[model samples]
Target chain A: MIGSEEVERETNPHSIVSVENLVKSYGGREETVRAIDGVSLTVEAGSIVGLLGPNGAGKTTLIKSILGLITPTSGSISVGGVDVVENPNRAHAKMAAVLEGARSTYWRLTIRENLEFFGRLNGEVGTEERKRHRQFLERLNLTEKMDDVVNDLSRGEKQRVSLATAMARDIDVLFLDEPTLGLDVEGSFELQQTLTELAAQRGVTILVSSHDLGMIESVCDRGIVLDDGEIVADDAIENLLDVLQTRVYELIVEGGVAASTRNEIERAYDVVSWVEHRGCTKLTVAVSNANRIHGLTGALVRNGLQIRSIRMDDTDFEAVFASLVYDRPHVDESRAARGER
Target chain B: MIRGRRGRLSSSVSILRALVTRNILIMKRYPLNTAGAIIGLYALFLLVYLGGRSLLGPGFSGTLGALIVGFFLFIMGNASYKTLAGLFATEAKWGTLERLYLLPVKFSHVAVLLSISSLLVTFFIGFTMLALMLLTTGTSISLDLVSILPIVTFTLLSTIGLGLLFGGATIRYKNISSIFGLVKFVFVAFIVAGPTFEEVFALKFLPLVQGSYLLQRVMNEELRLWDLEPLELSVLVLVGLGYFTFGYVLFRYFTERARTAGVMGHY
Candidate 1:
């Protein structure tokens, strides 16, 4: 039987942002684009929700509609408790967003000025709040460039300033669209750390769209996967892994190995994929039962291969997202209509 | 009762001031670009002043002086609107306008802030030119500063309102810069041609042009105070209100359209 607490958690109405049947279309004569279809989802208070989708999947459309930056052809959106269509300004009072490419800043403005502008726009924060915003900027490693023009900063630094500006308002909800699109490894990690602290310490509800599957897995409590402008999967990060029941395996063959033997091993078990690198045949096998790998190894040896190493691969979001979404049939353009639906 | 309701309406001026202050602060950080633009405006003024002297004969002094003043005003309005257009254009290009659309504030705040911020820069340039003119042209251009003060303020407001309207269009239409250029051509022509004193009788309803004509008439050594009409003053005020409302409504409409397209940031 399902636990009472589990049911309550699933049915709870404490979400910060909620949308139902959201739709958006553009253009008139000759060409029309249905950007968002019947998309419905909820982002809980203080939880980081990851929105993952391929290009042209209407992720931006969905985000814009929720923010009331765009009107929906048909749907309902509420930020906190205010309806977006009925009262967009009131609904927006609860949310702050950092859009793609750090476009939220005036290039001529200094980083400090950018923050000041956003803080004033938010209206809840006064002049004294600006002094506190400096501390936040320093924490985000933007103190050194406080007086530098926004256009002069590097792309990563510009994004940092954007985040600093968004954070200055201390809003209850934050929406980040591709926050770490082109950041280097260090920059991406630093941003992830800051997001984690913001959500954890401040109880801020965050909805993030990112290509960084690893960061999403580590930081987000739940994820919403969009395919063809529809919600394909909306579940906890752990549940997504459970749905894609596949584990990575690293195998090392010490003896001489033939390509045909590799083929024979593949014939014995579900050889999802494998790579031969530096004398090690690393295989990613999708075994229904864990014990099935032993039988596969026996078959490999009988086919004239010596197994020197066998290691169960790490279980993480990147592998799960790849195996579940990226490796699917949609990557083939022709098959898009079939599986993407 | 309606006037009371209108009086209760909140002033967005504070919002505009905050945004303008921010832009000024930003310009301070980029001193080189600001200095270069200011110097460029001065250089352009000199070129026009010297070049026009030879082309036109006796009336060159008064006409050129008036044209330069009009030119500065025209550029001031254009520059302010250009800032708004640039901000919207850049945001649309970079996908930031999408975020701003999602914010809680009124979308009008976006245009208002841009118009105010850019006007500050334009005013600085105009003031500098006025100072230079005072030093060079010792022939007292009447210097009827007292009478022209209110007219100047109203003129600036009407021009800035036009800027906001165009800025909004830039957000909705990606190639609005071409349209802005075309509109500016016609506007500058109206300002420079002095609109034939007879045209003022017809266009008394137009704010910026009417205000400019009234100021010019009042400041002219030959014109008399008895010639001024009460209807002209009231018409100028009405025209100012009209432009402000027209610009405001148009801005709100486009902002909504942009958001609905899910391309508020679409370049």
Candidate 2:
């Protein structure tokens, strides 16, 4: 998908958000920390990008630079074709962000007032903007609480209001950090659904950064993973999985396996995680070779351990992320310890 | 959506209107806070008037009229100073400061709109408190709009510069709010400063003091702004413009520094 996009000069012509070699460093020469080191990527129009990274992986630094919250030490960012560094005010009109999920709106302001304030600031006026406001209120499910001050809202409701407040603006791009942070199951699902609608229906490009891999899997068209201030992987979610061959499968056994079988299982397959749950052992086994699942299952049954459930976990982004950053060497490490490398 | 450079005038008005609307809505929401502010304003004035009266006894009547004018200017100066300087810190506290930076216009443009809105509100509150003080004391100064308006405008203009400077300092060195709170008390010094432009020519541009002197004359002598010496009026206008320009440059510098430092949301 990234290759299919048309390139004009260094950046894709259709990309609503583009950054080239962005480098942001903090502190001085003796002990400089490059928070963002030579990062470059482009988000095409209307695509939801999930920026996945561990803590201190430069995700925040990258988002802040693109949003014009902070200036990059080197390189360039452009929003909707306006160079961010050269003309920030012009680029600002094209972007908005819910940086801290629920704290974006004024706590003392009523939900409607917050919307009106942000909306008007985005250049939407009186009667002309009512329809847009009404639509988002309805979609975000804040219609009933429109008259209520934000301070009275529950955490979930407040997060929705924050999203609504940011989205109410006339913007071509929206950057959300931890978008599903305060949401429960239904709230997170609804937010994903709304984000899907925003991208698909309105063609509003979104760049979402969250540790919620499941939510990211459900909503994003592409996933970009960062590690140690550099991008470890960037591609379509399915492609990332396919290329990494992250054939991770979760095996829930009826009971705990004997020490010998467990040791043998660890030696045979790459065990990503082993946990005991409800008197059963849950082993996340990574099958590097896609055809090796049957061998592992046969060995498990032959060892007198009754199989409870077997399903491929490759569709889970956590598996793909682990393969990318935790490194595929996890299996190689296990094998090489026995001189298999 | 942003209508490009062509939308400059319209968007500016829209932004100003939005700020005014947001402010009024907040004020309307907290009626008690608004009322409390007025009462607090009056209480401070009364405290000063009583303290001075106690010290001077009956002779305080001679300075009563001057004290009233000084108190009015102090309210304006104090409010003006706090409004601009405290704005960034409060917004940062509320988490809306970054949003202001994200506006289509320069961040300073948003500050100006905010300043205009606050100016109107502070003026209303200041005048109301002024009225309350006059009613309690049964004394009135010349309320000539032609004379007082320009002088008051210049006085506010000068503090805006301080606001910008302190505001910029806030982004770089956050949680300096207590410093701004203490700085407002310096208005007392401005109030007591020598009021003669002829005595000290350099004193003409001394922030609130010079404006206070001109305003004291306007209220006491019923003198129009034009009635003042040409040099005095020009210098007053220049001082307002000069301080504002100084403040804006410093604000821009600190804002840029804050961006480089990436500490806008530190507080």
Candidate 3:
């Protein structure tokens, strides 16, 4: 029998997945590696969350722990209200995942057979459930290749088959570890669109860990950034960019600036780089605040520099990702200001 | 949309069917490999029989019968002991371990289902080997259902337990092939010693040895289960239950350790 409090906690309704103070460490006596160190976050139901990190950043460890594929050294993970460590079968019933690599499917089994097998394994035995398997194949554009053996299919087709098999089951949460890795631009875009639609139409809460920043930005509603076994930032994509203070400005000056003026400009702004070409000096500056751009341009005008053009540069997701994962001064200051200790 | 949950028994049956079907489909794709393995096993058995006959005198008919029964028991036991670990290693290497673990069933159930499926294949191979041996050697073998069923069941149960133990070890420590090789040698020694010498009381306590001795009596000497001493029957049942229970507990313990260490999917 479950207590009322336990039942309520398990059926939180708002969050599809919740992890708190999770820590996983390996090794003993002499050396120790803390893979996931005190990371806590909640993924709301029906929202797509991007787990963004560089290599060895604990993204896979966190995902594995949350899914109950691995037990954490400490803390707790609850999926769809059930504690994963305490009730793995119940927790697993609510989730499905497409793991890394091409090993997710049996190479000898046909695409249709693989789907049918996985569907049955996940408790989708009814005829209606079988129909859902076919529907997933159709949606993934794998209907015609359903009878083809997995080994003969291209890498992209095999990945789509994997996705289709996972999606065939009626699960509340989906975990995808690098789903778009090694895919062509079109293939990546197709998967991104499919994921977006799946989340939108079926209300599936998707937690995807990927290095493709552009795909993550387009597909994920929120982003959780990890760095060296810690949660560096967890917020909406735009808010994450803001928290990292990633703002870029491009300025064109007509006159050749002397060393004194260049030094003054560097002192006034965080000059990322400056290049002179065809008698025009193009200076790219990064500022912590958007408001500082106007003041810096005014200061340059006051220095008797002819401003040919001044425009805000479009900051892509890559710059924000690099700032959050790598050691950047602006990111360090922003983290300090946020008091995320 | 998700449907209502099915009964536990029904869901388990479905999972078993799917897993078995998947393995069968993969096996079907490699027809030549399957045939080669069966032929190779038969050849090995033939070589062992011929070599042993040459070493022993031609008048050793009774000893040869016991040896044939011992070989059959050894093959069955070896298959039971290796199947779970072999299947687990394959799944881990294929990166399907985590996916399989995600099924809405207990991990123990998944292992049991997979082992059962593998046992079916082993049974086929064992039967083929038995037929080939009987035809080639022209030995008359008889099976007493009332006597042989319980003995065979207990023997397989004990062997399956050993398999589960090794399977759990594989989950914890990947690349245990060397350890398996050593274990196979130990099992072969037990099989050879169990039938060759009847003076050692301690030898009967080893896994499958006592069962092999009893099976040989039923198959070769036509001894019914009722004719066997009550003490011998009791010992056989107790050993089988004890080994199976111990192996089940050990496997569960190792599985938990592997899960906590996050190495369940690592090969």
Please tell me how candidate 3 rates in CAPRI terms: medium
Please tell me which predicted candidate would have the highest lDDT against the true structure. Answer: 2
Off by over 4 Å in 2: A1-11, A243-286, A293-315, A328-341, B1-6, B194-198
Candidate 1 per-residue lDDT over residues B77-147, each given as its tens digit: 55655666566776677555755665555678656656666767777766666666546555355555566
Cα DockQ of the candidate 1 complex: 0.44
Q: Return the top candidate by DockQ.
A: 2
Worst 10 residues of 3 chain B by lDDT: B1-10
Could you tell me the lDDT of residue A260 within candidate 2?
Answer: 95
Q: Candidate 1 chain A, which ten residues in sequence have the lowest lDDT sum?
A: A1-10
Give the total clashing residue pairs for model 1: 3
Superposed by TM-score, candidate 2 places the C-alpha of residue A318 at a distance from the truth, in angstroms, of 2.0
- Retained native contacts per candidate, as fractions? 0.64, 0.74, 0.73
A1-341, model 2: which lDDT tens digit per residue?
32212223354778888898889999988999888877888889999999998778889889989988898999999999989989899898888888888787888889988888888787755675778888888998889999999999988888889888887766789999998886899888888999999999988999999999998888999998887677777888887667655477898888888889989988988989889889998989988787898898899999998889987853666767766765645435745686963
Interface RMSD per candidate (angstroms): 5.0, 1.4, 2.3
Compared with the true structure, what per-residue lDDT tens digits does model 1 show for residues A1-341? 11111222243478888787787777887897777877877678999999887777777778777877778988889888789888887777688788764566777778877777777655535667977797888789889889888899988898888888888776898888899888888888989999998899889998998777888888899887776676666788888767655566667776456788767877777777666777666666767667778787887778777788888866776666555456545455635655653
Off by over 4 Å in 3: A1-13, A29-32, A244-246, A299-304, A328-341, B1-6, B53-57, B60-62, B144-149, B196-198
Q: Write the per-residue lDDT of candidate 3 for residues B1-267, one digit (tens) a residue.
A: 222355677777788889888878877988887788778877887787888778776866656677677777777778778877677788888778889888878788788777777777777667667777778888987766668768877877787888888888898988887777677777777777765545777767788877877788788888899888887777778778878787788888888999878887888
**Lowest lDDT block of 10, candidate 1 chain B:** B1-10
What would the TM-scores of all predictions be? 0.84, 0.89, 0.90
State each model's CA lDDT, in order.
0.71, 0.83, 0.81
